[model samples]
Target: MSTDLEVRFKNIYPGKYFLSFSKEDLNTYLKFRSWLPGEEVIDGIEKAGESNMNCVLRVRTNERSFIIKQARPWVEKYPQIDAPVERNAVETRYLGLMGEDVELKIQTPELIGSDTDNFILVINDLGGEPFSFLYEHNSKLTGEDCKSMMAYISRLHQLKPVNFPENMAMRVLNHEHIFHFPFIEDNGFKLDDIQSGLEGISWIYKRDKVLKQKIESLGKLYLGEGKALIHGDYYPGSWLKTELGFRVIDPEFSHIGHPEFDLGIMIAHLLMTGHSEEIIPAMSRYSSEQAVDNELIAGFAGTEILRRLLGVAQLPLKLNLENKKALLDQASDWILSGMIRHE
Candidate 1:
């Protein structure tokens, strides 16, 4: 009784193969791929964390533990939403390229092995918790923490690899959510379900033609190519607080694009989580070889804020209706003015 996903995955390999949560099934598949030694015995299997795009599992063996990730034809968090399975290939390429830099290599997980045909990746489990706690009310990211986060991204942008994956599918999907869907008048996503009076607050921006035009322009910039390598989904969720230090994961949405997209995402999250005080200092800490366009960063940051507040990919925000409206107002100002006003 194999599901369509299991059947399709099996066809890609010789033996019966499909990633599952079952310990026995994972052990057999790992052994077949030589990812696990024949003698190794599976001790347990558990979910790694909250992942949106892929099935991520932490496989603990008698000797060692590692992570197994597989990308299917749909988003793992929301299966009805279709996505590209080849996104894993992009992540594999990003990891390979990052490994070339000493600083970046230290901050990223070691790529144990990969089966591109099955869209699976195996990497050493960097035991840690994601910085998702920042989403809680009144939570704050320390100065040192902000510094480390900025340092990793700055180093990552320094990479100048030739012929990177275009990642057009992921980009298109992201483009719709970030730049288009949330602004649509009747998109069917009920904002009031997330927060009372949120739907009313959202209408202000949805109807603003000037703001939408600016956002459309920024979206075009996002789809275009740039010289720097950006960690496409560079936020707290992808950042891990390990015993060693801060480690970054899930570069599946990565591409050669504007570095401000990453910085803007970071700024947006900081502002959303009540870390406004950290924004200016954090921006000061970010050191890029090329000049960063602050206005572009502001536009992207504002767009990210709107998308999170109004779109399907919601955060664990504890803001009240008033706070949300204020944020929306600020976001609109940032977008319309092309400036980040921290007053």
Candidate 2:
């Protein structure tokens, strides 16, 4: 990120790129340049990931282009503070562990570089590539692709959780308080909106009367019965398509939750994107009564993410919806009714 290089890059790709890069981009690269003693001109910064604060730059030295990812924790110039950047480093390590089983395929760029603090991961950004956010097209996922995603979950689950770090449970859940962020109310431990969406199974937090008590109860059940590493954020944006098949990305939220937590939420996202509600049956292929059991996941997701959208961790889906009051109303209504009718 030399001064000259940054200026030149700005001039070259100056218009609306996928994500924007700025003067600070130069500072990150320069710091890495000094740290790497002999590393020659870290390649120019071209935008990579879908996130605004994420910068995917090319690191060229010996006739090779290495992808460098600079992920800042806070929302860029956002109104409120955001998630920690250290989570990106956690994701890098999580992917490495997962790669041991999946071989990572070619779908993921090589994880050749990293700066643990700010989460600057250098990879091989294939030009003929689209990230996961772009891949969850309307019913674009087929039976095989669906199975592939499911199988990956099963395999990760099969990995003896005992083999992980000593404090495996806490490490997996990380105790990060995501469910409460976007909500405007301060109603104790229960997320009023998330709790409101339960179609039938409503004895969650109230069964214990105390959130810590409820969390302890859920923790016991989750650890005792549920047997998988659930991707806390398994919505459409967490995977990608490669020459061979599909590969998942963004394991930062790799928490140990109910498997349906991942599956149902994904199906919910598909429906949100206007996929035929009839495709709801497709969810069953993953597990027994998956659609019903995981319903809470989507129910919670629509409610929770909607809050995030209204808060700080907004996604492109919000922009796509374009602040339309009608769509927002429909989303809110969808959560309450639990009916996803194809538009």
Candidate 3:
């Protein structure tokens, strides 16, 4: 069945070239786009990391290595899930904007080139592991890490762009997972499969009409436009830890949105990773040029926590059933009260 599916995926898009893990195929594709000079030979190709959205590869040459990302009609991690291939253009535009800013350019990977027809983006690989290890038991982000992350986001929110991709398709897809799908009692996703008793624990919120109503309202706010250009998915997975400092990547979901959306998502992850103490301090590190609405931030934070617990985008959480229940309850409270209470 998997072999058949692979064959079908390869030929799914007529006239559109799909990237494979083969060095020969990549050499042809890269050279065609002039991304690889004629003299530069392709040494090898390997998976860059665990990318959930696109096919990301590290292309090694005699001199150096670079990363190439190709977006398909469906998600690279979950082929059954549909996503927009144009996200490559969105990310390319974002990187182009970042390249103009001195601070942002230093913190993000350099965009080498792009193949618009194939939805492929070639970027200079910033070698380092993501900050995802913070999800492990006893792992915590240092004060410096928190400050750097906050500072990058703070600067990102301050950028003023004349035109930007609406990214409504990506936003709508995220809206379903973040706000609507998790609350559905019969969404076909089994929470217990992720962890025992998680299904039973999720019912406490799923059955709550008031909580769902609040989530629905927050969903509308998320789908609406805002003044700031915010990174749509500002989580640990998108943050890279390198020798210089923390670098940000994957702005495919980025759009003109409220700054609180970014702040709230970051805070939610910090809380989940047992860094609740860093929440207040991290906010302090954020730029005060734009006033942050704590209530809005709390609402988005709570929503993100609930979705990660009950939605398809499950984390590498080390918490047990009891701990998850406590978090679900706390997330509900934060959503309803519009206040972040760490206890």
So what's the TM-score on candidate 1?
Answer: 0.95
Ranking by lDDT: 3, 1, 2
Residue 67 in model 3: shift from native, Å? Answer: 0.3
lDDT (Cα, 0-100) at 252 in candidate 2: 61
Q: After superposition, how far is residue 283 of candidate 3 from its true place, in Å?
A: 0.4
My TM-score estimates for the predictions, one after another, are 0.95, 0.58, 0.96
Clashing pairs in 3: none
Error of 2 at 290 (Å): 12
Query: Quick one: best lDDT, which candidate?
Result: 3
For model 3, the run of ten residues with the poorest summed lDDT: 1-10
lDDT of 2 by residue, 77-152 (tens): 4413343555666557665565565443344455665656445565555543433443244345666766776666
The lDDT per prediction is 0.88, 0.47, 0.89
Better of 2 and 3 by TM-score: 3
On lDDT, the stronger of 1 and 2 is: 1
Where does candidate 1 stray beyond 4 Å?
Answer: 1-16
How many residue pairs clash in all the candidates, one count each? 0, 3, 0
RMSD value for candidate 1: 1.9
Instruction: Look at candidate 3 and tell me the lDDT of residue 43.
Output: 92
Per-residue alpha-carbon lDDT of model 3 for 122-149, expressed as tens digits? 9999999898988975877777888789
